[model samples]
Target chain A: MSDDARDEETVTVAHGGGTGRTRDFLEDSVVPRFGGDADGLAVGLDALDDGAVHEVGDRSVVVTTDSHVVSPLSFPGGDIGRLAVSGTVNDLAVMGATEPLSLTCSLVVEEGVSVGLLEDVLDSMQAACEAAGCAVTTGDTKVMGSGDVDGVVINTTGVGVLPQGAHVPDAGLSPGDKLVVSGPVGDHGITLLAEREGFDIEGDLTSDVAPVNDLVAAALDAGTVTAMTDPTRGGLSTALNEMARKADVGALVDETAVPVRDSVAATGELLGIDPFDVANEGTVVFGVDAATADAVVDALRATPLGAEAAVVGEAVTEHTGRVVLDTGFGRRYLSEPEGEQLPRIC
Target chain B: MSDDARDEETVTVAHGGGTGRTRDFLEDSVVPRFGGDADGLAVGLDALDDGAVHEVGDRSVVVTTDSHVVSPLSFPGGDIGRLAVSGTVNDLAVMGATEPLSLTCSLVVEEGVSVGLLEDVLDSMQAACEAAGCAVTTGDTKVMGSGDVDGVVINTTGVGVLPQGAHVPDAGLSPGDKLVVSGPVGDHGITLLAEREGFDIEGDLTSDVAPVNDLVAAALDAGTVTAMTDPTRGGLSTALNEMARKADVGALVDETAVPVRDSVAATGELLGIDPFDVANEGTVVFGVDAATADAVVDALRATPLGAEAAVVGEAVTEHTGRVVLDTGFGRRYLSEPEGEQLPRIC
Candidate 1:
């Protein structure tokens, strides 16, 4: 076996540290496993989206599950509970599901964890659930010894029902398909990093963690949306690359068109990381067919969550499996992400 | 707020460290939170089973989600993938749901993880899904930098349908209800600890991480079951106490009647932990009405998974909210679990 393969057999602490290597592992190891069955049992391996969907009883259901192990538990942008609820709900919403109901929450809380804090987190979760139009139906709480855990780690699973005939065009991208982002990216990652590093940024720089179902619904209703994805862990770059590879197409993005918050850009510069590969909890990239691109953009703008929607690029047939950026200098080259940039932003 | 409240706000590593103090948190803090409407939501705070069931369109659905952050992702009994799938499915089954349709899985993998190893885990997960008669409908994969995690953590959410009027009792313990355990307890916890400690109880101890739906179905078919639970974290003692408290009744268990593998008992003694509080992966405690107790035991015995099933205890009105053990020496007293013994064994 190759050294790389040998290394895969053993697990290290760095994998959970939420750094760049995490992205690389997903691209190299995890993605290819689902080889081309976009609607099969293991179809999620093909699309780098927030969650997966399954067709049951003539209805497609969107299902997503997430676990939060953030050390501080509470952060500037959000806490573990908020992240847990928002992250999973967003996954379902991005898939165009409505009336998301019921969440199964399993909490692994350390012994001696304060009851007040747990109640506070639960309150936050309840609020999040209500905001997302869901309820916490069942949950399991296990308390370990004081040294057994950091604080509390929450794992949540959610189920949402997709509208009938809501066939989310998974890979209909052509050379002229427009790439539209619902809003700015990288705020969640940057905010998390800032909180961890004890750095302060202007404009609150809070996590842009919100449910995006309305934005997705508006976009879909406007016309034919070729594809949709939440730019989460690996940010826009990873998301675009996965889309291109899955659709067997190429994408040409103008770096200038992608929205980047000033705080996030500055934070990225200071940390020597590229914001393109950072994580965004609430951002989504929608690939729209050229004929209805304008209508889709307008519809997205109508939603409060999609006020900043902008067309960033076009899908291409050339340079298949490649994502190219049209730099202002007029150079054309592959925009391959250098490394796993943000490991644990999610 | 006092110092105790302040302490509650922060979670220390000890909570997840698999130790005694962890038990204290569950008994003292987490258990008291289930105080609300009981009948409106089946299996709500009252029973404290894996997931909650809600009435939906003439069908009751059981939903469950869990995260697998067990250190040494790959263990003798199972890996993170198998654990993730089985844990979620068992949660649904314990709620008396049948034929779980689909499971949604999300992975947070660290960078530098081997693709081949991930494939193994995925394959194992697929096999597990098949065993449980469920499909892997959706999933997400996120790779973080190596430092952010140990290797990979998996979060899975499952959805299942419960037959109409199949009142799967969460907690309705009345005096004279018989407590029937499906099989041996503490094997999974002892096996995990033994492996983690580099001891050699290998062959004799393997995690009993099988889906318990079939066993549950048998018990339900046998007759009316007053209460049912899977003795997982905090083991039998913790599970019984919770049931007793919820039912406003007490339990008297015969120590000698409780089934325990000799190997697990030896390991527990060596580690200074009680077998009662040790974690269990695949054991169910069924409280059946006294009239149908013999029939339930007979039904369980006919099944391969419950060959060793036995009546371990009975519920009582005296000493409500407490569990007592009837020792062979003819003494009966409260049997409270001391602390979080063997934390995070689940």
Candidate 2:
């Protein structure tokens, strides 16, 4: 079978990229396959949240674990160390949790890996943890021979507490819920791409790799947030599609309303890729009840991270499990993304 | 530096195999480094249990996550699927947990990986989970290109509840505490080695890949068990060294008391490897208080999995942080195991 045909049948390497294809593949193939009652489990397969929260008792705790095997350990936007900490902390934040306490880091370092490099990564991780108000309480280091492992792979696990009665679900969408973008999408993916491919770009589109818990708290306090998610791998479109499916609703999106930086657009066009599918390290897609949607948008706009926030879509009871885009001329169906657009770009 | 010197300084690809050199390296290097600090939150690294448990609230939870990457996917003794599930479950079992409730499997599959292979592995994993009485509740699957990934790497994360008031510490060693082994050691490592390297070994030394939680419970119920650990990765010497360090005690083991199968011993002798450091998937090393050690041993011996249980040593305060061997001829020092000692054999 041809590459494209095979890609459709099976997840391609590109699907591993934090791009549209990856997002689509996950929504179409993965989530539905693992059929289960997600009621109190804090499922994010649909919503694209940072981590997940399962209600255990009166207090809900946020739990998230991520493995990082990004090549060129150090990158222009952020290193694997920064990615590990930020990625985990963001998962807690999107769950409307404050102050993540303990973090565990497991390192699989290949023999012949430079001690200097390991120290550098650890230092970066330490700094990131300190900034996020978490401690690296436990860790495991295993050394594999040269061929048995890549240079280094770091798996980080995190735990945070969620407030009572503030439990947010990815399916928090209501009929009039407004969709808000924390900021422009595709910056992190694009930045990493530029570094990996040696692509020169004019603008300073640094990765927006910051903890969004505080920002999430602000939005939650502003009014009722129907849903919250971080558009990491598989980007904004994947997150929206998941929300729609989970809430048993449809989304009507205005393509123009979504924020896209000029540089990001140009880069996407040049690479023949869609920016909507590219992952963002520091971005959130939240759905708010229509009555409080305006206040939510204003609250987001007031924060530095959410200054460019916009109301991109509204939830509709019709077309459940579908997301439609109104592109001025006509309405076009936005299918779930599939496969990797930029493999290993995470 | 010469290859030999380099191997001494850092692990190499050969260390993962079940060769004489692999055993020697582990015996000389790894074990001594993390042998101490068995009490409280600090579990001595030497035990090489699937994971370490920390007391939180009134309960202690066994937390362990293992990344499985075995070549050929399937083998005579066990497949990657069974290994992933059994490995984590055994880790919890060694910690004296009854049933492991939830397990999360993360797959890093390469492009071109067959759907049939994936399904088979999953089926094996499911069966193992059912046998172990656990649920595969959550997971993440990421596909990378052929060159970017090995065929498939499975990482299983498990959490199990430790019975209240049933606390086991690494440092609970007293001079008279008896040492007991769940069963014969080195079968798993040797079997994997023979299969991978096409070694023509005759005797039936199948991988002892069975869960030993029942045996653990029997032993604990019969007596006051000071500490327990599964002899994975670095094997028995590694486990014992960790125990000694934690209890701030020393151990003088009778070399003849340690059980090794005829085939395992013959193979180790032929390969010039120390069987003590070879990995065993199903074995558990328990440090029991003197007064109840015999009862614990008798209870263990009642089970098929623990028929070969033996009291190998006594804890000593004089030789703190050290494991000594009474070879009948004289007293000799026993150091902790090091390096891979048959890396990836698990």
Candidate 3:
């Protein structure tokens, strides 16, 4: 059976992306049924927060979990090991965490996976942990029968130290708030897609997978940033949609203002995929006060990961729960997040 | 090719089991190379601790991550969801945490997974989290292409709050300490094997999947328990061997004293498996002062999950780094954990 036909019969590729069927599944099935709780869970499925915050005495620790099942475990610029660390590190960082402290690494390997390959992955993990300043604290390893799993899948859970008396309100977006993105969009997604599809028109289109905790810290220090999200699986569209819905505000973004690397845009055009619908490994979208938007953008540009940061749009008062995009021409239309075109980007 | 013959060609079923190839891989490949670190990791690959413990301010918080890939999704008595939560919960509990505060559930689903099956798994996860007094805090879901992954794999990471001034040294076993099992063993492993091999056992044999935090709390409250471990992948034999090796002491377990259900023993014999080498989901092995071992066992027996708790062995000053078992026939020999008979039994 063809891929599309088979996907319609069960779970579709969109079910794993940031928007589309993934959000629908969580909202319609998983969230409504199991979101509420009596326990002292500071954050859970209910809020759709990047991480879970648990009260710990006078302070709180933000925790997030992501399964890294990227294909070609090793890729340009980064590997799944690095992606795993960077993914969780960015999650906590976007949640206003200053220090990405400790992490737990869980691994499930298919039988016959070479010992050398596993060690290489471990070396990558060690290096990534060192670079991100996150320690691998606890973990478990399980091997599956050769045919049961493909290669290896690593899931990393990170705990970050949120500064005392500080929280970047995910639901605090308001009219006139500015929207900003860290660096170029679609780099990681396009890179993975190129590798998968064997696109040969590539000149070092490496993934933008790196820890953004330092950038987030700098932005927080510069100004009052309200909703913060790393445009990952669903890219910018999903990130803006979440902020718009939770903050009960509309988002007005300029299509021309969004930063997309030239190579990535060309690749996206060739693959028939929209940049906004793709995934990213190291990127942050933030809503900040209009007054400090420029300063925050400047602060972001000073960082390595956010060097190409730009002020893309502003939260608006109309069209609550929706995002509207303005073309470079005199055209305005509702923004629709495309279905999944990239799977396992992180 | 035959199963055994094929296994020899690649990663055999033994690599996934608690003992045998799994330990060897970690020691030879994982430990010597990637184990040493400059980061102040409290628990890592070196110690082989079930969970990693990190100091969070005045007190400590224990963190653990496990990827549950149990086949059949729905087992006779428990499903993968319960196993996922129970496995990590037990890991934290055996480390001496009375409560597992928060859990993050990450899922990797195949494109062909039915929506109904996914919901059922989520429901089980919700129920298991509620039962374990842990909340599903934050999670990520990814879908792989058809045939990329088998069914679904759930990775759960738990964070537990450690009580003030309470530290359970997992390797600090004294010669005078007695060894105990929280309840009967081999039920989970034997049940899974029976189901996989289509063994039509006469009596009902259900998996003992559960959270043992309450039992650990009771035992810790009752007396001086030096170390605690719940026999999961490696069962009683592996657990004792770990304690013996880490504590640099010998373990003397009485074959008649070790508690094993008659049905489990019979099933193990019939299947050519050793009861001691099999896995147990809800059981814990404790090392306590000889004077307090009975009281600790009594405390354990008071709990519903530990109703069959028994004092089965004691730490010895002789034969460090080894375990000796005394057969009822008046013959004693070294106990060896068998090759993997059942994979994915978590």
Candidate 4:
């Protein structure tokens, strides 16, 4: 069970999340063992952008792959189908790709799954594709024996075309950049946890699972967005730390300025999970020019998915390659979650 | 477990193999509900080619997705990682895309598996990618509980560039096109089965699992290749019949002309399976212009993967939408395998 895993004997849930462990696993074991050391990578796994960029003759294409094994195929605000489409599309979106041209889906279904359930998931996928203005041009389906899979595993690969040099990466952040979050954080993670743990609440707290490519496009077109990332598995803190390290700059974040929905904040506190350490499916944190940060936030606020956009942090050169938190009382360094916090939240 | 399954209540292995039951299941249950309806598809699922073709701005791209779940991860001559890459690269090749540019791999690994085993598989993938001359540009990894999945599952999606109007489809076979097979058939299918079922074989027999893009390129460049498809799950019979049905042309195949290795033929006979009805991972059956069929055969024979290339059949106008076999004993229509003759052969 052991080969190059840092502390654990085998893979842990943190390996799938946006944490240092995932990076370590990829770097120490995967990157060198496999020949991932080629040239002309706009954003390789080391920099860890939302998507990988490849330069074609006259156009730069964004490609991203994601596997959705979210438990309880259907949830409060969305299902695995919606999550699969939205998640892949957002990866392309944060890379400054406005419209994803094509997507290829491969489904691994368990033997005993009902035909009706499969149809329902397909319908959800169709709806999500329509919302994002992307088409599922090719797909393959395979059914596994009952115990071979839990229920279903979906892998969606998306391709988005961009103008020759318009694509962005996490390393594009500079010292004078400002960090803006598109919407409230931790709603998706908290909602999934509550549903899985049977936490009843008065108001409906839905998963923040929606495609944000349109919002990203509007913001990129209207202002100067140097770099962007969508926080999914490892939440806001991990994402910010990744960007900061990639650009070799320090992040000065104002704790009070971070946007968190009331219900999500309450649920996160009740569960003993930090809001900034949880996942968000529909939000993007952008590092933009400080002078145009206000305009970028305003442009994002006009989009349906970004009404709560707010400036939460700024890139600084003081503590290079780190994320510093400025709370109301004192200051601290925001670090990545050490171990597995949640699993199968897509 | 029931919704629209014709007879069975849930999905079966027959749905994974390229059988009529799979077609019926897709048509009756999937297509009518999932909205696969659209236009500008040179080869869609209805035609049942190896991949789908899409025309972008000034170029055409071939897209294919396959999920590899071969048992025993490691086999006689190849492993799951090699199968994943070769299977995907071959799909793009037979669709008139002889050079695939990029591939995206998403892996769903079960917990408790050894990290050493994972590294071995990744090494195989590296070798296969080098052989195919394609880069795995984007990837995702997710881990599931021990009992949720059977070790691991890999989904690879490939994208290939084609000359603007040079793409081929299942319906491209004309009345007089010749059917040429590149290399021997059933080696891969028989080898996997023999290893899994413990059939003792003499004199070094292994799965013929290799990428054949170079051979396809040579043939396409030298002669008129109207349509082509790699014989994978349902083998030569299924592939030829699919092209016949799509093009509304009858195929006349001579049993004596089909190329089969002596070892594979003997193994298929012992196992009570028809050699032509089994899969071949590294073989392409081409429908080409009859006038230059011999030239196409010579060009294919020059490549390493096409040493035994031969002309096996021809498209005819009579008995439209059917395939007729002439074995010198008598004549019979070659129908698709009724049910799951070989499960997980791909």
Measured by TM-score, the strongest candidate is 4
Per-prediction tally of clashes: 49, 22, 1, 0
Instruction: Give the per-residue Cα lDDT of candidate 4 at A261.
Output: 84
TM-score of each prediction = 0.83, 0.85, 0.94, 0.95
Model 2 Cα lDDT, one tens digit per residue, A1-346: 4545543465467656644555555555445543344445555344445555554444455556677777778876678888877877777777777566445566666767654566557768777776676655444555555655567777766655555456677777888788888788888877777767777478565777776767787788888888887887777878888888878899999998989888888877887667787778778999888888889888888987899988898999899978899988899877655755566554
DockQ of each candidate's interface versus the true one?
Answer: 0.31, 0.24, 0.50, 0.54
lDDT of 4 by residue, A234-342 (tens): 8999889888998999999999999988888888888898889988889999999999999999999999988999999899998888999999898999998876778
Task: For candidate 1, write residues B100-171 as lDDT tens digits.
Answer: 766777776665666677778887887777777776665655544455454666777788766554545547
Clashes of 1: 49
CAPRI tier of model 3 = medium
Q: Is candidate 2 or candidate 3 better by lDDT?
A: 3
> Highest lDDT, which number?
4
Measured by DockQ, the strongest candidate is: 4
lDDT per residue for candidate 2 within B1-346, as digits (tens), equals 4545543464454544333344443344333322334334333234444455644455555566776766667776678888888877777676677576456666777787765566667778877776676655555666656655657777776656565546465567787788878788888777777777777378465788766667777888889888887777667777777778767888888988888988888877776667787778778888888889889889999987899898888887788978899888998887755544455665
Q: What is the TM-score of chain B alone in each candidate?
A: 0.89, 0.83, 0.93, 0.94
- Runs in model 4 deviating more than 4 A are A1-9, A33-41, B1-8, B29-47
Off by over 4 Å in 2: A1-11, A14-62, A96-102, A142-149, A160-166, A298-304, A328-330, B1-58, B162-167, B302-304
Each model's fraction of native contacts: 0.34, 0.11, 0.60, 0.52
Per-residue lDDT tens digits for candidate 3, residues B1-346, read 3545433555556777878677886776556644654343455557777876666676667778889989878877789988988888888888777687778889999987877777778888878777777777778898888877889999998887775446575686889799999888888988888888888387588889988888898999999999888888877888888899999999888889888888888888999887788888888889999999889989988999888888888899997988888877774655557677678887
